[model samples]
Target: MAEELQTATDKLEDEHYPAYTMGRAAEMLGTTPGFLRSLDEVKLLVPQRSRGGHRRYSRYQLRLATRVRALVDEGTGLEAACRIVILEDQLEEARRINAEHSSHQPER
Candidate 1:
């Protein structure tokens, strides 16, 4: 029973990790595969490459793509939207790093 519980917990943890192929990501985001590839071409959202050179979109990338779509629908130009998304992501990452660093600092 303990082993079964551990397995279930592991599976849930894995699900929390980002991992997805371009096709699957497209289906989930209500976009086409070509659209994703175009995003890559325009430097909007680049996916990771597999051993075979196929594009693989992680959950993070998919969420960013969705944001891009939303911005576009809201009257933002594609290039501007992409730039905004990149900047926002960078800001979020910096915040996370800063928080982690502060948390690990030695007590005065």
Candidate 2:
């Protein structure tokens, strides 16, 4: 009974999680599997891996891939484009966090 309950719980968790396999992620992002793997190899987009060694991509990764595609469409090389995109994304995220933090602070 306990084992069955645990299995059910695990299934529920999996269903609620935003996890995607490599092939599914590629399809969602409108890219080839090889291209996704190359992005990972280049450290442009790293996905979470399961204990069994399967790749799991999140929604964040799919968004990043879309950004990468846009940059490429703008005539940027893959490596350079990825670097620029990552830097810009980091800066934007930092600014957003800072803005949220400052909004919560007591105004002078």
Candidate 3:
């Protein structure tokens, strides 16, 4: 029982674990599988395939999908939304790296 609980707990926080099947992911995102397929077509978030040839999504991918869904709900074209999300992500990573580098620098 404890082991089962531990496994569930780990899955709750494992960002890269391919835990969600296509139907489940789509349901959770309040969208359809075709929508996810469209995102895949644009190379926005590629899901991992299970050994039995099912598409599996991780938490990270779900987050991206959620962002895309939000943008699409706001009337953004899928391709443009993908580009915007990618740019936002890149900008965020740059800010993080800059902050880390600034913190590591010694005062002159």
Question: Candidate 1's residue-wise lDDT over 38-103, tens digit each?
Answer: 789889776778898888876677878999888988999888888899999899999999999999
lDDT of 2 by residue, 50-102 (tens): 89888787777777888888888799999987898899889999999999999
Task: Tell me each candidate's TM-score.
Answer: 0.72, 0.76, 0.85
State the displacement of the C-alpha of residue 39, model 2, in Å, after optimal TM-score superposition: 0.8
Score candidate 3 by TM-score against the native: 0.85
**What digit string (tens of lDDT, one per residue) describes model 3 on residues 1-108?**
999999999988899898999999999999999999998899998899999999999988898889988998999999999998889888998999999999999999
Candidate number achieving the greatest lDDT relative to the actual structure = 3
TM-score for predicted model 1 compared with the true structure = 0.72
| TM-score of model 2 (CA atoms) | 0.76
What candidate 1 gets wrong by more than 4 Å, as runs, is 1-18, 51-53, 106-108
Q: Point out where model 2 deviates above 4 Å.
A: 1-18
In model 3, which runs have C-alpha deviations exceeding 4 angstroms?
1-12
